[model samples]
Target: MTTYDYLIIGHGIAGATLAHELRRRGRTVLVLDTYQTDSASNVAAGLMNPVAGKRFALAWRADDFLTAAATFYRELEQRFGQQFFFETPILKLFSSVAEQNTLLARSADHPWQNFVEELAPSLPPAPGVRQDFGGVRIRRGGYLAVRELLVALAAEGLEQGWLRRETFDWNQLVVGPASASYAGDVHARRVVCCEGAAAVHNPYFDWLPLTPNQGEVIDVECSGLADTQVLNKGAYVLPLGAARFRVGATYRWPPFAEGTTEEARAELSQRLASMTDQPFVVLAQRAGVRPAVRDRKPLLGVHPATPVMSILNGFGSKGVMLAPLLAGHFADVLEGHAELWPEVNILRYHALYVAARKEGGFSS
Candidate 1:
């Protein structure tokens, strides 16, 4: 049996970053996971856009999160010897006059004005990208090489003997007051579950309001499109160098089956057409479920009754932007150095667990 300070379940963005933070703090860790092609982290485009939605409302704590994320990825680059994060301007194209007016109104303000560079009606923002609507150049925007980073992290973990490529059986997880034991061969002081959408089936944390959505992205090879910037209106086109781009995505809710579908392919093809009429070839299509939440917040904290088991999930599409900083914050809380932020802490939903217990319809 090998006992560690922590056992992290999942190698997605959240688990990888958290494990790295803990190990950097000199804690021994073992990551238990098997690669899944359709997992969000594997198929993610890793887009980071602060100027979001039709109303141009900024993402929550956008400034703080953006700064921290940049620093974090740069630090990862130093540690991993690869460039994972790329900083580039995003060209936000306007679809209609009303949308353009809203952008103008926002740009007229002090901070909003500082974040954008005026563009003359989408005048060929990038090669092969549309030029009809004129767009605003957003300063704080970029993409993380999500899939590549995970592969690298997995390789590193495997080389270091801290990552086991296998499926985790729930029946084998035993939680104690001060520690956890798994599969008869692993013991840890605490177990942190970062299992993405799979948490819906977790007996210990299923009370959470996790709203998983099916998202799809398509890869294409366009000879003319440049890799210097990202383009967004209804959908996004992220350049992957060598004239390749990843275009996406379509969000599907419940009653939807998992995996890639023809409908999504057509829908994305149409959206890509709307972005440009340039020549391109579809290289591949991917489908994954994003672990979203009703309140659009990341879930963090330990099980109420089972103190040795905790979770960090529901990051949805913002995992790249939110995980790095939040992992550090949560690490601080786990180490008793700081209190968990009220907005994202799982303690807010303890009442739901209590209510479920009273109803006698829940799992451990």
Candidate 2:
């Protein structure tokens, strides 16, 4: 019969960040989660790239988010005695002259130019590599050890009696105007749902346009590839220390299935084989649903109809880079210190949902 100020469901990146923030603010927080079943955080390559690999466009709010996320992880490491963040560069191999030109144009006027290093001319491509332009170096880009960080957070929550190891049953929830009660004993002033793609099943906030995608990846052990930097030619190859690399990511829509298939393994092996002729051993493969949106921004803020509920999911592929800053913003809203960002707030979805409902559009 323990009551808390905040109850978080899920222990993925978003939920872990929220719990960390609330506990840091001296609030009693509870987390209910069932971890390690193709959880997006566990399967994530944890790569943070400043420039999108396809179009070379700068990531959303790269400057603000990058600095804040780095500081957040560093501070967390110092506080918890665990190293969660690594500062490594991303070497993006250019495909065509047109792409190289676009990169040049962006480098001149882009705000994140300082983080981009010119490396197209001198660095020769490795054997069996071919490209129109050499490549560009992304400064201060790296991966977060998401699994380790979650373990540390869960340990902290356990020490404080704020973590429950079980799946949450929706039928046990009793909502009120100012508070929420879960399973009769767990009472909280508010509840924030960070259940990744599962948020679409939430009764109050399900109407938002959540375009979830299934991404599959392969884990391989390659002997010679350096473990310092994330390499990008066509598919990304993230070095996971000690000759282990994670290669992956095929994006598919709707028909959501969280199991890796033989076809996926073949596709990923094809791409990895194309990257290098080096012998690699396929160790494992996994697939998980990323909580993406049509507009490619995070979905954050309070529920429109139910004042006691809120959500902090929909980080999509950039959960590590996006969650730390957005979690602080959510904390600000809960503390009544600031308003939520309009571009990312769920209220915009509510507005659109209302309009669509009036126009006879299908809404939840």
Q: Model 1 over residues 7-71: C-alpha lDDT tens digits?
A: 99999999999998999999999999989999999989999988767676678888888899999
Provide the lowest-lDDT 10-residue window in model 2.
Answer: 121-130
lDDT of 2 by residue, 48-110 (tens): 888875767788888888898999999989988878998888877776777777777667677
Give Cα-based local distance difference scores for all models. Answer: 0.87, 0.82
| Model 2 TM-score, all chains together | 0.92
For model 1, give the 10-residue run with minimal summed lDDT: 117-126
Show where candidate 1 strays beyond 4 Å.
Answer: 119-125
